[model samples]
Target: MSQAMRSEVAESWHRSAAAGVDVGAESSPITLPEDDLVEYRAAHALAPVYPLLDDALGEAARACDALLALSDHQGQLLWVTGTTQTLRRAEAIGFVEGASWDERLAGTNAPGTSLVLDRPTMVVGAEHYRESVRPWNCAAAPIHDPITGRILGVLDVTGGPDVASPQTMAMVRTAARLAESELTRLGGPIPVPHMIDGEVFVRADVTVQCLGRREAVLTVRGKAQVLSRRHSEILALLATSPRGLAGDELALLLYEGDVPATSTLRAEMNRLRGLLGEEVIGSRPYRLLVPVAGDWNLVRALLAAGDVVAAMRHYAGPVLPHSDAPGVVALRENLHGELRATIVASDQADLMAAWTRASWGADDYEVWTAQRDLLPATSPLQPLVRSQLARLDLEFA
Candidate 1:
């Protein structure tokens, strides 16, 4: 779209917000660069969280707190923090649930606008495109997954016109950091074992586990306990990564601390297969029994919780030999790239939150370091990371 046309559209959007009309249907008269904006608005109108998020939003609303609401990468509004009254208004204005904060939809505001600018921002009064919202001011920052570099969503604070102060924005930023800290905790992938019922915990059956506080392993028909040490290791590794390992790669990983000969490796795999049975084992490359995806694991559960850091803990070790295999190695690297990309795209607060957790040697320190190396020194996460490393050094010494 042309600059003049874009400006016109932006102005129209603001007008629509002022008029308290449905912007999604009329936002077309105003035009801009992002086609996805309309789509986002329609999608965002849906509620992302129900009664659970209502509690936080309710608290903020009740307290008449200055607050912000956030969404996930898919643009699902996942969290709301700050004043109870403002949160209620935000929810009433359709900030709850599957809302899209991407710039194309909500013009210059905390959630949608910040995602577009890819930076922190404050949208006050006329700056907002919607008419009914013209009286409010909002500030926002974007959050990202440390490894994936994918924008998780915008962290925003919204309130009455007067409440939109620098102090309020600072408070919103702090809340955003807490949310991002939860994201940091989800950075790693971990094994989640399922509890088996009356069934046998034997070698032939594939086992899936529950990762909750009461942990247990289960199978299709019954409980199983026939897995050998190496088999158990393989299960645990795949459980963590959710990506299967090849025979040679698994061999290398199995021999990491104790180097086993290739033949021994083959024997161990054969024994593992014998226990798993041919039915559970799939085709070539990933010839192991029980496909990795079959396991729900802790990481998957954590991801569902909106905590990216917890999901990351399941990575176990570097695939197999942590080498460059198509299965384990490739997935590991993919996750690493995801982390870097997501972190790169995140707002300063989000990046620092991630750095704070990772730099402290939370998951695999070496892996965390490798990911950190990808960022430039000027990156917002740099200072926090350096501080954390310094603290770690002091603590270890």
Candidate 2:
């Protein structure tokens, strides 16, 4: 760990060292088989943007004997593009698609370090943690979910010392942003990556987010899709009702006064099934075949785990705030009440403070008062708390 190493690279080196990676390993240790790699890349979170990346970086990569590699959030390489000579040269060091370049397995490298920090990073020759990687210079940037800010994957350029230039950094970084911009227009997956043995790995799950936001975001197996209000309501109802709902049962919950015709509900269900797979929504009771989780569920779980701060972070706001469906309305009020009660009961001043700052809780007298009680008498925040409580009192009066 030389002070000559840039802080980010130095930090990654430390992490790579501590992870027990074999510093002497010549090639990346985690390589996916060719056929499996093909299928995996085709279904990857970055699949949609591959052609764009290829067109954007393909020529530039070949021009300078550099390779553009797109990796999943876990640093598993999905696409590696270069000219004949360049590709052959890179394969000498196992820099190919279907290999994991994560720091723990490959030691410190551009794409690996980018996933670790979730930011653009550059590693010049000899700055790399592994001796074998020291000859190549690379730059990488993490691509994220446009809405929720989850890291989806990484974009990297690996080649001769020319790859270390700021221009190379700018190109790779810009390409990463462009890919996310494409995702914003076209829906992309809400990928979730986890840490294991100091490595990032993705586990599949279906996530349906209908809280706070007017439109719901549904993600299945790393693919995200925005839903219409009706579909959102349907999912909210179906998710909450685990045992499932019959056509009439769902219609009643969905409608305001009278239950709609079975045809209407049938059409909606059919469309929803088309969007989320026919296997996802089952019949005879119309249950969710896959276990779905989302911000709403995560909040409940965090609260149960007694991590109130984390729960509040995930809360976003009441579930399906704009939905007037009987089931959704009931759900909205209950979850809001539970969250508010939890905040008031907890003695953590920070929790109360955060609650009071939210738009919905700005005038909440109860939470402000709870916050006032939690703050120490000598605390500097007392005046602000007192003023909010006083303002709440006048508003209530």
TM-score of each: 0.34, 0.53
Residues 18-104, model 2: lDDT tens digits: 345666788885567888777666666677887998899878987998998888766788888888898888776778888889776
* 1-397 per-residue lDDT for model 1 (tens digits): 1234345335334322322334433221222224544344334311232233345343553355565466644334555555555556666555654455444355444565555445566777766666556667777666543332334456565677545678656655665555545544544111112221111111223444322212223343333454433454555555554356666666655454556676786666567566666665543454544533323333344444544433433323222232332333444454554544443343323332333343322533443454356545555445645665666567776
| CA lDDT, candidate 1, residue 86 | 56
Candidate 1 lDDT trough over 10 residues, lowest sum: 191-200
Name the best candidate (by TM-score). Answer: 2
Model 2 ranges with Cα > 4 A deviation: 1-203
Q: Predict model 1's lDDT versus the native.
A: 0.46
